[model samples]
Target: MDDGTRLGQADHAAGPRPPGVIFTMRYPSDVGFVWKTIALHRDLIARAFGGEARCILAYPQLSPTSAYQPRWSTAIQADFYDYSAENRQRLERVITDEAIRLVVFMSAQPADVDLGFLRGLGLRTVTSENNSYDHSLRQPFMKRLAKALIRRVLKRQVFDLHIANSQAQYDFLRGFAQLPASRLRAVRNGVDTDHFQPGERTGACSTLGLDPDRLWIMAASQARPEKRLERVLEVIRAVKDARPALPIGFFFVGEGENLAEWRQIALGLPDAETYRFFGRQNDLRPYYQAASVFIHGAFRESFGLVIAEAMASGLPVVATHAHGPAEIIAEGETGRLVGRDDWEGLGKAVIEYLDDAELRRTHGLAGRARCVALFSITRQAQEFADLLRPFLKDGAGAPY
Candidate 1:
């Protein structure tokens, strides 16, 4: 790795320079978690390499001069879908100009990007798998066929490496996709512990117009059918019915195709007044900090980023025993994990935390500690640096 002084120095005038890296994804809205995660990874990678390794963001829809600049040193507008000769030449120009050696697809799929074209540039490429393939196959016919086709095409693509966000995904790629083990890696998603730490609820409550006296249970994720948010609503209703006088509220953040439907369902519940749906929040720290406990109802999450974020925010997690949550939550120490769709068990766990303030405090602190030790963004950066180091070329100021 380059020292601080060397990092600040200009590139050498002679010989081919050490290559940099570009993380590519669909330039979707800034409100979602995918973009935020990619930005954090880029920032940490640059920091890990002592600012020697240049990190850039490339997206199909992002404008070169967009008003909303991404949080990176450099960004380029390169369309992956437009496979015209002109687009290819433009992308080649970007690779040469930026000395890009590695292309890591953070959110874009093989179908979205031309993997063969990227490999032909003599660049090492990586694809990060963030979804559960098994669960995807369980979708309706058309959706399942689309997912299967993507998986088939992904298997045929000649990429340098494949990263799975969770161990279950790694297994799927290894067994179901039949990818070589040498080219596969399981890197669990991480959270920025510094940004999502324990904080006083007063400011968050005041800002969101939440009652400070009422205990809140929070769930922050896209309201997709696979998320099983209806299960969470059922639990909330059950809890309220059991404890009619308990001053408890449910704070739901994020919007999706099913968000409006879920909102309507929540309104039908007897404790409808206790539920608040703040759709698609740009910042989720306040909601996490203000909540007493965090619940996730996803039936099969490859890697529950929200669960890690909730743990980092010093909120005890009551999540389904899905792949990611099973790995993140330390059963008795940090939080509780019930079987998927086990509304009764989930409610019981929520009640356990709500009824005892001391238990909540102990578990919340433990969860935060676990996040710092195992799931911090800094740790993730180090892991990625180790993986990418061997592939980086040797040159002056290179992170090798």
Candidate 2:
């Protein structure tokens, strides 16, 4: 991995433009949320720094699911297969070559990489933790202890700034990681309200081959153990048991390893014939528009991005009282929040929305107003700029 040359060699050969920001995430999946965050905020970050700001992106691999071609800035593929001295030296080339002023490490996994080296190069540093309730935080004593120790060790390297996706995440960093409050900032994840807003329901369900007239409930999340999608199936079954005569359908979007298991569970339930699985999708607006209610069964999240999107789309949401959702959902207003493990409560909430059309409309309208007022991408971008203002002076760097 070594080119056998010092960092200065690459810097000497670089262009005359001011060193811009470089965001490092080992894997940059095209359809993944992190990539979407970069895409949404890149231009705004650049504008905040300077009109001529150039943002460079570095990642280990492109996701196979989405064809992610970078249109806004330069992309560097820095393979992190081996975190050896040679690889570290080679990775530094991307930084030196681009003359990056500030380096934002997007994931907590790689934040410890080249710490002293980055400091020596006078590169401003920032790190972000996106998971509010990490699954390991719920593991058994020995495993949890081991993870805590590992996390503590990995985060020994301090940053100029720390970004938390939600207040819960911000609290986790301060409490568990002992990150200073001065360095921590909680910026809730925002949605593209315009793209995900309410629309005509005429073809919304039919386009997915679903009966538009029947009541449809939608849940979108990666089908994973921690997400508790199985509980969603249980909620569906419980709802059916409680309301036998109600004609209802369930629609699930997004895909993961647990998707097959969820599908199998969905197949065996009563009225299971109405279960619709629209695997990983690039467009989710139609699903949100067609649904009578939006349901989220995840036990935890860094920030409930999908919940905000659903609200923006004017759908009444029923989600578990997970870390992010507990903070996001306005109970009995925009949506309802049940205990994370309460399947019956989840079912009851769903049924309430199903039985009453007036309830759905009232909650949906309120949710939309709340989402638009509080969680727009433009608002988040500005918050980022405010947080990053101090660092972007004369020759300071950009945040990711």
Candidate 3:
């Protein structure tokens, strides 16, 4: 890792003193919620600072077709996962060259990469703890224990501030991780309301080759076990079984380890032709716009960003009562929430919305309203800017 030139460098040297803030994350081929959230935040943080701060994306590597390809300001490619002294020296040079005053780990510092090294350089370090402990508990015992221990050590040792993406995540850090209240802050995820807002469904449906007459229910996320997409498939099966004549389709957008198996299972279900898996879509607006309802069946979600996007798209939601969804959906108002594993309840909720077009419209409008008011990208940017303000100021200091 050499002191490589920054990609898409902005002309910050000519204007008001703008503190450089680097957001570091793993830039893999598959675009997930974390990447999207960080990218959106980076752009918004730049705008919110009004020339008082410059935001940069620092990632190890990225796939050629990655949706997160940097479009503005500097994007530094470095070995963020490596903590060797040689790598640390290179990272330090990159930071010094960029004049970065603050560094935010998109999730936490990688297991091998220690934040203490960065903090020792007199740089403000913060960790946006995105994963939930409850979700980790679902993992195998040894893996769970290892993750818990690593996070505990990192949170207690080097990170200056810990930002939780949701109330649920905040609680987990407080109660489970046992971090002090002052060190933890809750900042819920936000969606780009302008991009995801309601639109005419016909064009999107036509482009996707979906029948305009059929009611489309969409789900988008990395297909993982905890996502419980199989449960959503069961709901779709039950609905199709009960109303054989009704034209309804289930369209999933995203690819993951379980996607192939899930797709196979979907093909085996009755009305298989109507269930489509569109893998790793670069643009999800079409799917959200084309659909009449959005369904999320994740067992535990720190924050369901897709749910907010769907709400912003004016689609009524039917999601499991996971901590994230429970906070986002106003029960029987914006959307319906069934128990995490309540297959029957999930089906019933979907059916109720499908059967009543007016009800769907009402909930959809309300959902969009809620998102615009609470979960807009601007609101999230403002919260983040406020948090980073102290660090950006001259002579500002951190607790660690």
Candidate 4:
């Protein structure tokens, strides 16, 4: 082996490097959680399995060129709609020249790259999120008929094989999308445990000049309207009515379209200090550690990655039994999950857990345990490698 270039199979005790390319748009640089998670875990895979991935990136015409930085390494980049004949030839050259083994399409990017071209190359297509028929398809007969005709011939190459974060989503794809069940694999999102855990004694609520002893309940989000913050407020209001002097506080994290309206609603709630807004924190672990409970009231989420972080931080979850949490948490075992659209049930579960200090600790501890056993960065890389194995090196095994 070259002295400077360490051998893949025997480099270090961390683990063997898996062979082949891994792909994602989430480079380490992006401020968002999705980007960071992909960035950090790729580092982990590179350490253990000697893996490399190519990213297929495109920028919107509105964005500046400065926004396009390669996530892992300098591999691939193209304009979102710059697929002219000359450009297509350049991309074709990239596909052949670099020997890219597979492609992972992040739903966040504007889809380009002409599906026929990708399919013609025989590149394995992978999508990270689920896709449902556009709600616009249900609008009217003529429109629906047109979309139905388009859907028949416009097959998405990315859908043939996908890695989902939840079982419900996996089922949604297989049952509704007509994909084979064998092709759909489940890869649950994981939290960066080192960064998120309980007893972060920063006195976050206190630092903000809020009461230190309040039993704070936070519904953390960027504050979108469809999130059903009204449900969260209704439940919190009812809970506070009974325990008039309870030191319970509800916090909103980050800013979004509905911030003003939600703030107005928060003002009407008990003590008004009962509701607080903390705009996006670059470091969110302390918030998870600070709260006695973490609640999510989103109507739709692919997976509430924050709930995983909250669980990792040892705060019991009181999330809607919506798509993601329903798949991640075993209700009554890990955290309390209530029916979707039921603020009364959501609030009741949260109040019940808060009142029983022992149960809170027990459930929180169980959640943390589940997080460690089931969702780790290492396990995430391994599962991903399992999916990639069939494609790597002679197609006999995944290179690990």
Candidate 5:
């Protein structure tokens, strides 16, 4: 918990020089939860190599890329996504001409980056994710067979280290994926403490146009099926059915495939007028500050970053007691934990926070303190950089 002193004392630069080019993808600058993380730590990664960082972003689609993108200069057209011959050529040309060294894979998901090109780097490339998803259904028998043959494309030797944010990811990779624990390390995900602190509910409600008198709960993640939106709807439905007069507000932040369906469900709610869906927000501070509780029902979430953000904003959480949530939310300290697929249990927990101000305050305070102590990015990056110390010497970073 006392990670500040540890960060202050650790010699983060006591490691060896990097092998070469550092590769990563660009995320939209305004997607607060995920983008804010890179925006906060981009400099630390750059400084790790003394500004020798050469990164290639698959940024054809995103806008306002890399808010505080590092100070190093390289020679290449600031290209977009790599689906075409021209785009692929621009990327390959940059890699070949620059003699790129290492690749740094963040954001966990491999939706953007070129997995093959990074493998060709031959130096060391590492990837880190907040948590792991249940990709068991993603591959079929033929896909698995193909992956077994071409899986060399994803060989670990190319990536010297695969860092995870919580024990859930660590155990999944070790037990199911069969990755060596020595090659993978678990670190806590962080939050922007300065921005996401506890604030007066009055000011927040006034600014965000939320009713200060109503009991509001929020779930701030992409509205995907895996996020388990049905449970939230069911819980609110139960609470509203029993206590029809209860003034409650439900807010969903971010967007995804099930958004239209979720909106339909929201419209049928008893307090449909109070329900709010803010799509693809770049800033969630106001939402966190204004809400009474943050609830999550994801069947399999990676690390639950928004939970920490909410805690940092001094909001109580009521998350299901599953893999990722088990690690982030202490049973009674940060918020209540209920069973998954149990709408009654989740609803009762929601009602508990709604009615008890003292309980919410106690849990919210603990969450904020925990976030400040354990989930700070400075601590995460420092511990992670320690693991990369042994792999940096082969870097061939030429700025092409």
Candidate 6:
């Protein structure tokens, strides 16, 4: 009620039936990798567990800065209640009333609910990937110290199970949190293979009003500092200069604080007209479909969801060998992994694919195969369900 959300409607609709799992997170808004994963999770859980599964999502509020409006999928049963300290009583009451068996704190961000609160309620608890510790190492000491405290709390008291999205993240959680191997699980993120699969380029290029003749290299991400948009711009510039005769175009799709800054940088480049920026697109499939290749230069990511999406779209990728991308891209097979901040290396990698159409086709097909086998939403959700299954019945997987 504090956030102007109604819990009564969801409760009334489900009647007295228990929701097998309750997922609590910081935000519920659209247009983030986390929310996208949650959408897939909800769909998969319902399919996997059927009537026996009633998953309820709880979040504090919508993303204030997001360009897209908040919209929830019809399939997910959600409550938009405020989880501030002041609204703790309401949160507790709703969890109790819904008969939640498992309480999953989606991130390590301070929640409206706390571990002690859940433990006091005798609820089985989980804390999923908070952030990339590998990425944090590059931050200022104060920021890194703050993350350390959060990691300590998560390791010592908060969760019965800690799920990391990558092996690098798992190592960080295991060592930093001092969590036992039994208490932690590494689960990679997934993409909707069907929706993201490859399509004919001509139609997509026409829909977006782009020339199909030029070789299109696309990057879709918010213009955040950690995303290294500056590095991406530099790579494209270097590649263009090195191969002046090559007809190439780069499209950037997404919005953020650094968009104008990046746009300005792109404009001053040699072939400024070739760079197109689409601010905050709802459907990224067209961008992916029309691209000859996808490139990402983020310094770090817990899981490279965009890279996976690009691969699912059957586009070969050139990404930094950061925490997430290093694991996702099968170097020399699906895509190439350049060192972080290595703009020249990244440029060369992109050029290699652009110069050879046969190599691009082979790698794109390989990337698609890899995504179908390892990163499908259905497979991801089923893995999540397996982790959650033992706890729903009894105290088997409950906290110690």
| Candidate of highest TM-score | 3
Lowest summed-lDDT stretch of 10 residues in model 6? 67-76
Off by over 4 Å in 5: 1-23, 26-32, 47-58, 61-85, 96-99, 107-116, 119-121, 135-158, 243-245, 394-400
- CA RMSD of each candidate after superposition: 5.9, 5.0, 3.8, 7.0, 7.8, 4.5
Note the residue pairs that clash in candidate 4. Answer: 16-48, 17-48, 17-49, 17-50, 18-49, 19-399, 22-53, 389-398
In order of TM-score, best first, we have: 3, 1, 6, 2, 5, 4
Ranked by lDDT, the better of candidates 2 and 5 is 2
Residue-wise C-alpha lDDT for candidate 2, range 1-400, written one tens digit per residue = 1332223345345546665677665455466533464455554555555544566655665454543445555555565333588777765676676566677766554344666777777778876667556633533677645555554455444577888878888887766665656667888778888888898775887777888778988988777787888878788877877888888889898888999998898888877779989887766888899899999988678787889989999999999888888777899999999887888888999999999999999999999999988888778867876776666467544342
Q: Write one digit per residue (lDDT tens) for candidate 6, span 1-400.
A: 3343334455456455744576664554555543555555655655676656567555555444432332321222234234467566666666676567887666663343466666777777876774755544444667656655655554444467778877888987666555657668988788888989899998999899999998999998767888888788888888888888989999998888999999999899877999999987666888899999999998877787889999999999999878888888999999999888788889999999999999999999999999999888888777777887777775554533
Total clashing residue pairs per candidate? 0, 0, 0, 8, 13, 1
Residue-by-residue lDDT tens digits, candidate 4, 1-400: 2221112233334544333353545332324433445555554544444453333332222122232244444323333234688766755665564455565655422254466676576555566663322211224567545543443344333344577776666766544444445556878766677667777434766566556688888777656765778778888888888677677888877667888888898897658866888875556766776688888887766667777888888888988767877766768977888777778888789888878889889988899888888777678766766666566554432221
Total backbone clashes of candidate 5, pairs 3 or more residues apart or in separate chains: 13
Where is model 3 poorest over a 10-residue stretch in terms of lDDT? 1-10
lDDT of each residue in 40-148, candidate 3, tens digit only? 7777777777767777777676545556554444566666667888888778777776688998877773354576677677788877877744644444667646555
Model 6: residues with Cα > 4 Å off, grouped in runs = 1-16, 32-34, 62-85, 109-113, 135-155, 394-400
Report the number of the highest-lDDT candidate: 3
Model 2, which residues run further than 4 Å from truth? 1-16, 32-38, 62-72, 79-90, 109-112, 134-155, 394-400
Off by over 4 Å in 3: 1-17, 28-34, 62-72, 109-112, 135-155
Scored against the true structure, residue 249 in model 5 reaches a CA lDDT of 80
Q: Of the pair 2 and 3, which is ahead by lDDT?
A: 3
User: Candidate 1 deviates by what RMSD?
Assistant: 5.9
What tens-digit string does per-residue lDDT give for candidate 1 at 1-400? 0311112224436565556887765554243454566566766776676655677666565533343344435555565556788888877877777677888776445567787887787777777777654444433667545544544444454357788887888877766565656678888778888888888987788888999888999998877888888878988888877777789999899888999989999998876887999987656788898999999988788888888888999999998888788889999899999988688999999999989999999999999999888888777877877777666655422122
Q: lDDT, candidate 4, residue 373?
A: 81
TM per prediction: 0.85, 0.84, 0.89, 0.75, 0.80, 0.85
Task: Tell me which residue pairs clash in candidate 3.
Answer: none
List the global CA lDDT of all models. Answer: 0.75, 0.73, 0.79, 0.62, 0.66, 0.75
- Model 6: pairs clashing at backbone N, Cα or C within 3 Å: 83-112
Estimate the TM-score for candidate 3.
0.89
